[model samples]
Target: MKPAVDAIVHAFETLDPEHIDTLEALYAPNARFKDPFNDVRGWPAIAAIFRHMDVSLVQSRFVITERIVDGRQCFLTWEFHFSFKRFSVGQPQCILGGSHLVLDEGGRITLHRDYWDAAEELYEKLPLVGSLMRWLKRRANS
Candidate 1:
């Protein structure tokens, strides 16, 4: 289980469009994956989401800073670094998030759910919506 967890972390850190085909090897055939914007089932669908990320974003990478493995489940805290092609061209952005992953006995992820703040991590980084989101956040805090 530990080795599988380590392999997953390594795979995520070096993941790219070229290696997108390898996603099926890391998850079960009917794996369920969900994030802020997508809820998809099956390895094919999961691979599609990653494929979209590779094509849509300027650069995307993940760093797994922490992990806790308990039995067949592992919780990982990661920082996703990326730049949107149309928005922040050369400026790198980061999203602090975590994932809850449940693995089968064979060490293949059966369920993956990512947790992140869409308002702060994504919407607030946009061009027009950024200003509005920031303003609203300031007002709410005040």
Candidate 2:
């Protein structure tokens, strides 16, 4: 059997908010989720994270570049694009990043980790701090 995890991966690749409904069918009642800005438990909380993303982000889209599955875990390499609201010392801008996911026994995600170059993708999108951030990243990488 291909397992429900495959279908879950497909749903994310499609980038449709409605697809989240499929999660209810796939996840355990007490699934846990963790990401850059969120560390939440249960299906409702995880759904809220998606809900927030749907409402707060403008033109947000996720494109899965690769997927690897081992037993109950599925690691997804993805690229995301979204507009961010400018904060006190930042400019409204677009950002990009990758995600990694770990599924549970029922094929529900138990852990979600996001990996991205914050300086290049986020800090560079800032206002006054952008230049300094870019310089620091360049210096650190080189």
Q: Please report the candidate that would top lDDT against the real structure.
A: 1
Backbone clash pairs for candidate 2 read none
Native-referenced Cα lDDT, model 2: 0.67
| Model 1 lDDT per residue over 54-94, tens place | 77696799999999999999999999999988886878999
- lDDT scores of the candidates, listed in order: 0.93, 0.67
lDDT of 2 by residue, 16-90 (tens): 566666666555677767665777878888888887876656556677777777776667777776665434322
What is the C-alpha local distance difference test score of candidate 1? 0.93
RMSD of each: 0.8, 3.9
Alpha-carbon runs more than 4 Å astray in model 1: none
What is the clash count for each candidate, in the order shown? 0, 0
> What TM-score goes with each of the models?
0.97, 0.72
Once model 2 is optimally superposed onto the true structure by TM-score, how far is the C-alpha of residue 32 displaced, in angstroms? Answer: 1.8
